[model samples]
Target: MSIWWSIHLRRDAASVPLARRLLLGTMETAGVDPDISYDLSVALSEACANAVEHGGDGDSAEAYRVTAYLDGEKCRIEVADSGPGFRPPSRPLPVRVASVEDEHGRGLFLIQALADHVHIGGKPGLGGTVVSFDKLLKWREDAPLIAV
Candidate 1:
């Protein structure tokens, strides 16, 4: 069985946990390993947090979209928002956000560390950034929705 879901959420701090809880519940019902579920949830939180923080510069978008797919033996997730798309440096150097006192920059790296595969890009017409990632799934022994 395959499971997929997508939701458009308000770009607010409260939306982060709402997305996490939904992901966690889906994983739990699907009998995904708890550890893997936790990892995915954490990644989702970071992605959602990023969307809330940058998805709208308080002028353009008021919401972000999050999508998840559980297919075969792997699970893929994506978070996208309508903002002034992410622009990378010419040389791709690590950037420090705002200042040393500001808590930022580590979220994307943490997502990369947690997920097996990660992709970052922008949606052209939407004028926003898209962060998508995937990881191999580990199932509980008695999982009802075990991937074939």
Candidate 2:
């Protein structure tokens, strides 16, 4: 299997759904289990949404990139944005909100819950923030053969 699949897309609300769909399709093609597909999709969606919402500066539409890698029994996805990376919230995420509720702040927490490993750091090549998550493929004893 190939190590990476990558794309750069506009950082806007409209792009979020497309990004999610692309990630889901990639995972399915890579033979990820159906059981955890939704979880993986949701985590990628939330990660991309965060990058779009809090990414870059000014009114110019920024570009965000997503990269997926399939390595043996694990899959990794990285979402990056060209923005001044802010320190992650110090407190526990607000799982529920009051009458006047904030819809944000739950993304990182949710991503942590859904992924086997989550990492946040500056982008490798350019200057930006990148968030990565890895999912370990659960192999069933009776699983069919996987062609190399």
Local accuracy by lDDT, each model: 0.88, 0.76
Q: How many pairs of residues collide in model 2? A: 0
Compare the candidates by TM-score and give the number of the best one. 1
What residue pairs are clashing in model 1?
none
Candidate 1 CA-lDDT value: 0.88
Off by over 4 Å in 1: 59-61, 88-102
Per residue, candidate 1 scores C-alpha lDDT tens digits across 1-148 of: 8999999999989999999999999999999999999999999999999999988888434989999999989999999998788774344335444567867777886787789888888887668899898999999999999998
RMSD after CA superposition, every candidate? 3.0, 3.4
lDDT of 2 by residue, 1-148 (tens): 4556888878878888887788777666656677666787898899888888877884446799988776777778899999878665455445554345766677888998899888887765566788899887753344452324
The TM-scores of all predictions, comma-separated, are 0.88, 0.80
Cα deviation of 30 in candidate 1 (Å)? 0.3
